[model samples]
Target: MDSQLHIFFFPYMAHSHMMPAIEMAKLFASRGCKASIVSTPANAPHIHKAIESGTNLGLEIGVLSIRFPTQEVGLPEGCENANSLTSLEMMNKFFTAVNMLDQPLEQLLMEHRPSCLVADLFFPWATDVSAKFGIPRLVFHGFSFFALCALASLLRHEPHKQVSSDSEPFVIPNLPDEIKITRNQLPDYMKEETEFSGFLKKLDESELNSYGIIVNSYYELEPAYADHYRNVLGMKAWHVGPTFLCNEEKEGYKAVRGQEASISEQECSNWLDSKKSNSVIYVCFGSLANFVDSQLMEIAMGLEASGKQFIWVVKKGKHEEGVKEEWLPEGFEKRMEGKGLIVRGWAPQLLILQHQAVGAFVTHCGWNSTLESVCAGVPMVTWPVSAEQFYNEKLVTQVLGIGVGVGAKKWARLTGDSVNREAIEKAVNLIMEGKEAEEMRSRSKALGVMASRAVQEGGSSYEDLTALIEDLRLQRHCCGSK
Candidate 1:
């Protein structure tokens, strides 16, 4: 059963989900294992480009393209990934399109008969598909332990339902610490039982039934939560990440990561060269965040007022004229001049965070961005827009003390919450200046060191990864791969 070992990764059709899985696959490949990432045609290019370096180094990493039934589900063609989604309503259709991949993926399971399948949280069906072929399935959510623990508590306790108002804070019962959250801050699906809520219930059952979960987290970052996840909640998990760092050794590797057509890493790096160490702030929302024009204007004004060196990567949209630059203050770019760099499309995020000039990050608290900043030792002004970002905000500002929240009191997939200029300025200043800021920086640097240690020999993540690969090898032998 252990003959010619191979593993397959099927991540949700989002860059955040796919890239980490790619890195995880690379880690397996580097350890003399063969791995393949399964993706649709539209999303396979990203997987192909990301794995190029590892593949060139003679690692047996490859892409296994799967067909997504786009036309049947009524989503626009080429809408294989969530980044291409324009609205929340379209997301349902896109997922329906994704769900349609079950048959094709099942066929692959039958044909490949891989040792294990590491599937995304979105694909609860994979548990059964892999079981059909006697293959183990591990869940990858691209999140931290704290977020998962807190979410588990929320779903189990229903504390938010007991609260009187959206703003009324309720203690998330049975966590490692006392954490309070409001109804508004939770995902819209969690606020009440919806069609999606039913789906999440299925996801939870599948997770419990799967072989184990894979997290892009380290033991040191949230020791209490990690322990609680395994011990108290009774879940099997391996924290083998910040997975993106697995193969960052190659020269000019940053450019290939999260690559887009515009704004090369060299261009971004040259701009950072002029600034002093820990002087400039890097601002970026994750790909799915769509801020209304007013919110975008507020961000521009807030950054301008902060009087700090900054780089803002604007998320490109489908609008012909692009959601009105009139949202920007008049002559704003001219006024800021050399002090500010605004990249209209993709910016090399990992490269920018690792640079010497980056003091703080004003981030939307996406798990990848949060972990990237943590790895870089950059403190954050946590502006959580959607998903489990609010839970991550709590982890940073409350548990870790490496970030300050920007008073983002609401959550929506397409965020229209316009936090005032003052709140943004205050959070930025707190993360960048004063004794508190210095202390936060010191703490962040220490955590960054821990992150580095986690990936090195004898580290927790290193051991977990080794143990996981070996366990898969053993499982293949014992279970008898069909």
Candidate 2:
């Protein structure tokens, strides 16, 4: 076995995708592996900072930046990541730019010849590229085992095909758990034949041939789904996460768009200090989530009605003009004065969740957000907006019993359907003070303890990480001998 096994990581450009991979790289480096992460120039700063933090802790993690083919893809310069792109058309161009990196990535791998490659699922060609250099490629899903298993089952059975209407509910076939999903909740790629569907099909096939997968979850959190992915799906996989917990400070990586501009960290912390322990609700959607003006008004009214001490991070809406004051319900801010704190742009989510005053989270149920909530031991009021969030909502509300949904029956970007103030108020009540909320809070606290333990020495995720490093070393040796 190599004395210092070298592992290269390639993450998709989105913040949610890149952050986990960055943390995973730091984890590998902390375990005495030489870890390198590759990203476009525009996205490299955050990765570099994360690696620098790892280096401060004596981890051998480095960042390599490549020039994104912006002009070739007809995209504006610096439109390298998913969050930076403005429209679906630009998104398509971004994918094209990502695909164009195949040749450069192949050249980079061949020259460096790392022991293993950890890549995002978006890069189907990574398996082949790694194989060309005789290195194992482990696909990273950036999702929970539960969401992965459910989506895989749906793909295999195509149960949504039987439903004639988008509103019709259909039971996902061949799943270990009985889960019902409406047709509209399905991702756009899965609901109809599209170019992205073809891309995903290829990605799935590539994963089958790759070495295995590495998921950002822990064994105690989803033991059944982990087993199903291993035994039922017949894949070699490792669970070595809640990866963000690996960072000692847990200050959160600097986002590509930068930090929250609305309030100072000290001000936010001081505000929380004034509140009782577990008495505040923290509301934030992931980076990509946007709401219409009408929905924003509904949310403003709902939070006022909940009567709970809350801190809400409100990113500017797509249709918003001038100031956010125009988007909110008239006189809403004045009416709620001391009851709520609204921070515009990116809030320090990890920091906020870690605060003692935060009791529950109102989240879009993104995998990263969900895991963060769990690690914080905070219950949730789930409002799933898009992508795999709906499935993640199920994991929170039904499977884990640590969350209550806001009755979001359909999926839409920002325009389709609005969850009124009434539903939001009800969900908030359920998570904040309902009889069931007490039980959920207890369960959440227990799970948070488990999550924290899993990443520590002699824990499940810790052991898995050790095993993965050893296995990769052995595989490297085998390849070298051959």
Q: Judging by lDDT against the true structure, name the best candidate.
A: 1
Per-model CA lDDT versus the true structure:
0.87, 0.85
Tell me the spans in candidate 1 whose CA falls farther than 4 Å from its real position.
Answer: 54-56, 317-324
Encode model 1's per-residue lDDT on 1-482: one tens digit a residue: 34767989999998888888999898888887889889999888777878885454778987888888888888878888888888767888988887788899999888888888999999999999898888899999888999999988887888888988999988899998899889989988998878899998988899999999999999999999999999999999999988877766677677778757368777788999999999999999978787877888888998999999899988855324645466679899899888999887788888899999999999989999999999999999998988899999999999999999999998887673569998988888888899999999899999999999999889999999999988988887777634
Off by over 4 Å in 2: 250-262, 317-324, 413-417
Per-residue error for 11 in candidate 2, Å, reads: 0.7
Model 2 TM-score, all chains together: 0.95
Candidate 2 pairs with clashing backbones:
none
lDDT tens per residue, model 2, 195-218: 999998998899999999999999
TM-score of each: 0.97, 0.95
Positional deviation of residue 94's Cα in model 2 after best superposition, in angstroms: 0.9
TM-score of model number 1: 0.97
Report the poorest 10 consecutive residues by lDDT, candidate 2: 251-260
lDDT score of model 2? 0.85
Error of 2 at 169 (Å): 1.9
